[model samples]
Target: CDYELIKLRSVSLEALGENEPGASISRCNTLRCYPAKVPELIQNCCDYLEKNALQTVGLFRVGVSKKRLKELKDQVNLNRSLTFDVSTNAHDIAGLIKEFLRELPEPLLTRDLCSPFLNIPSS
Candidate 1:
């Protein structure tokens, strides 16, 4: 039998918190200025990484379990609150953040801004 394919759904950051009055201050195809300003998944992952994984070498280069990563992605796509406990692997969260960006319907850096970002000089 053939393996069943799973079609992952990309979360629309702009559409988040739209149902709540005054929740969104502004909306764009790429990003949203909602009450929180950033998507919950991105904020949580960054917070976790800053608090726990800042010193971990190769934070983003390291790989995590595919199954676990998929589970995490599913949780975020389902809009479930994520709790990263001490037992959670930082690599998984880092990978999740990368996956989230990669899966966006539009690139975080839109085509118009790509050149400007690419032109930024290195230190």
Candidate 2:
């Protein structure tokens, strides 16, 4: 399996505006492993969706501008949820297509492998 693991950690530290010891507030994030073929499939799928399904797909469908999303986080409510929703939307779109390629009334084997992004022990 050609696997990749991308770990992202976000830490927020309260402003030490006055006489305060430095401390960090952090949330550790772990996303599930996915097949490595996903990004290309997604770009292709997005092309179709953007042309036809943008409105129906909602905010998560196409993706938000990173700049806008960041600004919203600093200035709006439901910011965190929006960020995650956008990510989830991208994953969901890719996942469903993968499933479709795997089986339907008929079945097709895309590859013989475990999840590509899985963390496996090495000898």
Candidate 1 C-alpha lDDT tens digits along 1-123: 111101222334444545344333333222333476576557778989999989999899998898988777666546444677767899999998787676666786889899999999998
Model 2: per-residue Cα lDDT over 7-53, one tens digit each: 11111111211212432222211221123322333344565556555
When summed lDDT is taken over every stretch of 10 residues in candidate 2, the lowest stretch is: 1-10
> How does candidate 2 fare on TM-score?
0.20
Enumerate residue pairs that collide in model 1.
Answer: none
Angstrom error of the Cα, residue 44, model 2: value is 1.0
By TM-score, the best candidate is 1
